[model samples]
Target: MTTTSTPAPPRIALHRDRLLPAEPATRGIARELYAAVRDLPIVSPHGHVPAQWLADDVPFPDPTALLITPDHYLTRLLHARGVPLADLGVGVADPTSAQSRAAFRLLCRHWPVFRGTPVKLWLEQVLVEVLGVDLVPSDDTADDLYDAIAERVADRGFRPRALYDRFGIDVLATTDDPCDDLAHHAALRDDPGWHGRVVPTFRPDRYLEAGLPGWADRVDALGEAAGVDTGSLAGWVDAMERRRAHFAEHGAVSADHGHRDAVMAPLDAAEGERLYARARAGHATPAEAETLRRGLLFEMARMSADDGLVMTLHPGVSRDHHAPSRERLGTDIGADIPVAAEFTEALRPVLHAFGTHPRFRLVVFTIDETTFSRELAPLAGFYPSLYVGAPWWFLDAPDAMDRYRAAVTETAGFAKTSGFVDDTRAYLSIPARHDASRRADAAYLARLVADHRLTLDEAHETARDLVTTIPREAFRL
Candidate 1:
């Protein structure tokens, strides 16, 4: 059997009206609205791309390392198809090893599995628009596709800072540990040649979770980093305050919370201190740890209220759901599963305490779409401090985004909702994801115009606001 190396690949032209309404009249409105905001500078107020990628300004290694491995969106699907992660370069000692080429080949072979999925759309967009690679990915074209991309990656023009500039990103916020010194963020900001605005966000999940292994060590490390003692709950709070202040001194405007639930029922300070003290001494039980976690969440809200860091909370996902996979490959390899989340009752304790506090800004994200119209939108509708976060993580698909807009608009309207957030670690997908968001919003706004719910002018304005003004305001950028 002979392999056909020069097989004709499908043309990769993107439709001008993709993701817009199918009806001619409404589609025309969506087309105009999308064209207006399609090239708007992306205001990425919430994301997971590392500041170090830009700070180093290094050329990306290869296609697999750049596109496949770091992106759980791609890897999880491939893993589900029984393509071992190792073959996709998941946990290899060297990403440049032979496994990378195999990974790319395997990925191309399995590309059809990504059909009708947002990941496929994003990857195709990246390949066509971002990478400027001409061929569609498949077993027939994998080698040439990989070689062409590898050549581009080897060029200085394809370096992180260069791509950051090319992406037209106005601002990028990265998730950072509270204990992180944010040295890379500072370096990027301070570099005379670099002018991109990259900011840090305070994330203290490990230190706050008392039941987790290495939580004690993380607490001690936070104390060391902040020059404060973590002897008690109050001292730990002090340490957290110092770190938040430090993050602010750099460029942070928000603190991100990722937990199984959004608990804010405050315990007695003394009781909370006792719980922490027991944990510090290795005598804390699981129940005590749960108490400490909730109390710490309450304390965190108070701290946010006091210090004015926008509190962005998301719950209802069981992280690292497959323990065996997580243990073998480490965490965030995308084995997590989403569960139903209760925001109304779960957040009452915190909302009652700080919902009206003028300084506090609470933005809540959820994978559980069930809560949007029923619980989240209504809650955000009333709370001055609460803003409904954009459909994020598992809910960033096109239909999900459309559903999100329809769900939240009735109660919270456009202003009370956090605008599109590209919650991704895949750096190049920033614009593709943002583009998907703009098109989705344009389509939604066009429907409102067609239904006589909003004027066409109003819909256009809302589309622009969703792209720029709303994200800036929600994250307080």
Candidate 2:
């Protein structure tokens, strides 16, 4: 007699209560809190997704490009495990099918490296939840999973804008250089067929870093973009203000800064002009550049006070910490490492100037977790214009997020905390990142409820606000 048997179930499936508390009572409350906001429209006030992708609304080439290549969070880990970035199609404009397939296989074969990581959570979510791939990633399942994802991405309905809608993103913000023409943003805005709200964020980090190579040329480019002559400090300021106006006219709600530190100091006009000349002439010492950058950051806060653009700053990053990696693959390939940050003293000058300014809004972010209670919470508690930014960058993990809520909520309360910011370049992982944040927050709130610190009704209300009202108000959306 021959017997037919059902195939074994897939190796792994996402747990319905993956990040919920282990205790039954807290878990129940968390499940309820999560259900209330699980399907809410995503409000991404800050990210690095390119505007052109949505403007063109093109179908992604393959799973590797869509999932593995563009996400440094994955690529950097793969690179650490003896994989060359080039082999992973890191900078390849159009990777051939074979190349892409190999990269995907490599990722699958090395999936163990991502265990206990948020990358694992996001990948599993994307594979099963987003793309409907049932099989777990492994050496044996790489080809099948790749084929499945490739087929899905090839469909017209899987185009960027379609996915944007499918992701239920109410508002997505893309970071842009000060010299950008924003033509792609204009295209999306003018397209009558599109109804999604995508806004540009003015990121002026490169323009402010006088110590970087080609600072003068970039300043000149910035001036040309704004139709001004940036020959002096005052001229540069005027050019930046005009470009900001242009951004505001095009619906930008925030200005982003990612300097090395959070220092914002004032400079006299004479000293500012002198430092500007030195920087432009390529003769500025490191100290002079530091002074100029800090003064310029102070000016940025001043500009925000005047223009009503929310000033968002994430500092304490030592960008390109690994010189060889940067030289080999250029920057932002996840070599950026966080250093200890001192916000209390560094931000004193800027805070004193704009902390109570009615029009000024500053959201400060850091990867350094130590600042949560010691510095950020107290600052946010006292300053009407300041909001403690969510756990960001490396600290965007579950435990860190729970710690953040515990640390800040005591002093600043929920209202003074900026809602979760994805802060990602991996466009496809946006939903997964936000989902992780939501779950972490729900778990935290459930603990509060279980501990009698908050009622269930209050927890539900706060959960809703975290994903909606908080982000809108924090980013001034």
CA RMSD of each candidate after superposition: 2.0, 1.7
The residue-by-residue lDDT of candidate 1 on 5-41, one tens digit each, is: 9756886777778899999999999999999998899
lDDT of 2 at 333: 83
Best by lDDT: 2
**lDDT per residue (tens digit) for residues 108-136 in model 2:** 89989999989999889988888988787
Query: Which segments of model 2 are wrong by more than 4 Å?
Result: 1-10
| Number of backbone collisions per candidate | 0, 0
Candidate 2 lDDT score at position 364: 93
Residue pairs with backbone overlap in model 2? none
Task: Name the lDDT value of residue 119 in candidate 2.
Answer: 92
What residue pairs clash in candidate 1, if any at all?
Answer: none
Give the distance in Å from residue 368's predicted Cα in candidate 2 to where it truly belongs: 0.5
